[model samples]
Target: ERLGEREGIASLPRPAGRLVWVHAASVGETMSALPVIRLLAGQGPVLLTTGTVTSARLAAERLPERAVHQFVPLDVPGWTRRFLDHWRPDAAVFLESEIWPNLLAACDARGIRRFLVNGRLSAASTRNWRRAPGTARTLLGGFAAIHAQS
Candidate 1:
């Protein structure tokens, strides 16, 4: 059977307890998250999501035991909804700065707790964020907390 032929996310062996949804923008973010993930998984399961194909592959190689890796769904409302519904994470953490409006809204609606780790507001991105304060504020407000890198 072709992958994704069915309606939802790929099946991985689900962990025994609570799951942490960690989103990484790329390889570096994935690597940086691994240690924290290990620490978190000591408490519960870890589900790692990455936007790029390469990052997914890297996570598959580097992810610790009890950590599952998968590609992140596009930020379209429908896809994000399906992805979240399937995974049903207890908490979420977005590495670096991936501010997907639809995804954040979905998380908010579902009442899934979320965090932004290693968040950096670069000078360029800060200026851009300022230009559209409403949109930026909406996205930023979704995070339960932000752990800035610097």
Candidate 2:
């Protein structure tokens, strides 16, 4: 399943009308994102992408009716483009500290509304990103807004 899905390949067709894309990298993040995913599903179909098999299984068992789970495309520029081209999400909402440069750039280039929810960064991560300040700014600055939690 992962082999086929990794390079932006998906088995399911994108749903019609407004689609919101939410990505959470693992079980913990997925757990944190559930309520937000539920809220967004009320508005439109939500495509929730997770990176691990365990998380995908968890999402399958737990996700709401209007929410669909898929493995996130690998963070390659071409792969990201393929995923975005197929889905064409009206908006992209990402959880926690994930900072996928290629994926964010792809979304930005396509003019998709992007948001970061429960945004957080460890001191080490902050230091790492600070090392490449301009790259961090360009990727994160593209977000329409960021919703950080306590």
Candidate 3:
């Protein structure tokens, strides 16, 4: 399946109890999120969403007990909402640059705590975002905490 497709999202069963949604687009992001995922797993189940098969395989091999992988749905408002509605994660963690406007909006609408880890925006992207500061804020405001690169 394409990374940005929502074909299988609705079929996946969400485990009962608190679940943390951790999104990592690929290998690098997955590697960066593992320690955090493991920690979150200690507290509750973790739903690790990645955008590729390679990353999914890596996650399957390395994810701790109570941690599972799912393909991230397309960034469509309805699909994101469905994903969130079904899983009802207690919190969400986005690794590096994995921001999705629709997904974040759904999270905010649901009052889910959102966080960013090792986030970074390129200088050019920063300048572009500066051009529409309000949009940037609206898109990013859902994050309860943002741990950006130094």
Candidate 4:
């Protein structure tokens, strides 16, 4: 059975208790999030979502027992909404800077707690964000907490 079959998402059983959703964009993000996933698993089931096939494979091999890996649905509103509705995550943790406006908006709309771990803002991106402070605030401000790494 394919782990990230989009159609299969609806059929996937919801975690029994609190569900924590973690978005790790690719291999590096997945690696960075492994320890965090383990920690979150101790509290509740963890849904680890990554954007690349390679990351998914790595996650399967390395994620802790209580963590289930999934391919992150596209940032499209409909797809994201379906994914979020089915998973109904209690809280969300994003690795690095994998920020998806639609996904974050959905989580914020639902009032799901959010955190950004090891976040990195490149100099160029910082300049762009600085140009549009309001947009940056609206998007980045949604996170309940941000842990940055130099």
Candidate 5:
């Protein structure tokens, strides 16, 4: 079933109109993005991507009619490029701390407007990021706007 789900992602048809890609790494993120997905679907087609099969199932059940769910590809450069090229999303909205360097770089190179919603960094994670400040900046800078919660 998982393999079938992943394969289906590659076969998804491009949206007829504008496509907005929303990525949530797992079930919690998927649930949190539901309302936003619905709102975006009203404006244009929404492609919601989640990394977990459980989340995919939940998304399939709950997403609005105009929204479609897909499994997020692995964070390999080629795969990310392929996914982006196929989806051609007008904008990319990512939930929480699901930042993938290769994916963000691909999106940035494509000039896709990127947003980070409900972002939160743990104290330990912040300390870890501080150890690699350049990497942190490079990744976080990709987001046009970040709505973080304390």
Candidate 6:
């Protein structure tokens, strides 16, 4: 808890400006969001969150000057609530189909605008999504916007 308070809540030196919260699921998602992060950081602070140790390290090396990287907390309710309270990002961009139900619900509840970039639902995954009709519809409804690669 202390570590999270120390690092997670550290304020950016830059003046308060638009913050773009980029949530990437892993190394690939982290890498894919680099261009967007670079563009957005020029406007304000960028907080990059990934679920893997490797992605955290990679983003540290690769993300832009005003960008900070951290491992995303597990999507359990309490942890996510803490995370949301600390960061309080202005906008959120999720890369490559990372649709965490709890996280998305929290974001929605907070009125945090969200976008999904480079997204695709594979046939296998689509079948699974279909099985959970309520979950799929609920999750799908939360995305404010989506950008597909092709």
- lDDT scores for all predictions? 0.82, 0.90, 0.85, 0.86, 0.88, 0.80
**Error at 142, model 2, angstroms:** 0.7
Candidate 4 vs. true structure, TM-score: 0.90
lDDT of 2 by residue, 39-116 (tens): 988888999999999999999899998899888988899888888888899999999888899999989888999999
Backbone clashes under 3 angstroms, per model: 0, 0, 0, 0, 0, 0
TM-score of each: 0.88, 0.95, 0.91, 0.90, 0.93, 0.86
Clashing pairs in model 5, backbone N/Cα/C closer than 3 A: none
Instruction: Using TM-score as the measure, name the better of candidate 1 and candidate 4.
Output: 4
Best by TM-score: 2
lDDT of 1 by residue, 42-65 (tens): 887899887677887898788888
What lDDT, from 0 to 1, does candidate 1 have? Answer: 0.82
Worst 10 residues of 2 by lDDT: 1-10
| Model 4 / residue 91 / CA error / Å | 0.5
lDDT of 6 by residue, 31-125 (tens): 88899999998888898888777887898789888888767777777778778887888888998878788888989999999998998887888
lDDT of 6: 0.80
Where does model 3 exceed 4 Å of error? 1-8
Clashing pairs in 3: none
Ten-residue segment with the worst summed lDDT in candidate 3?
1-10
Tens digits of per-residue lDDT, candidate 3, 28-84, equal 999989999888899889999988889989998999999878888888887887778
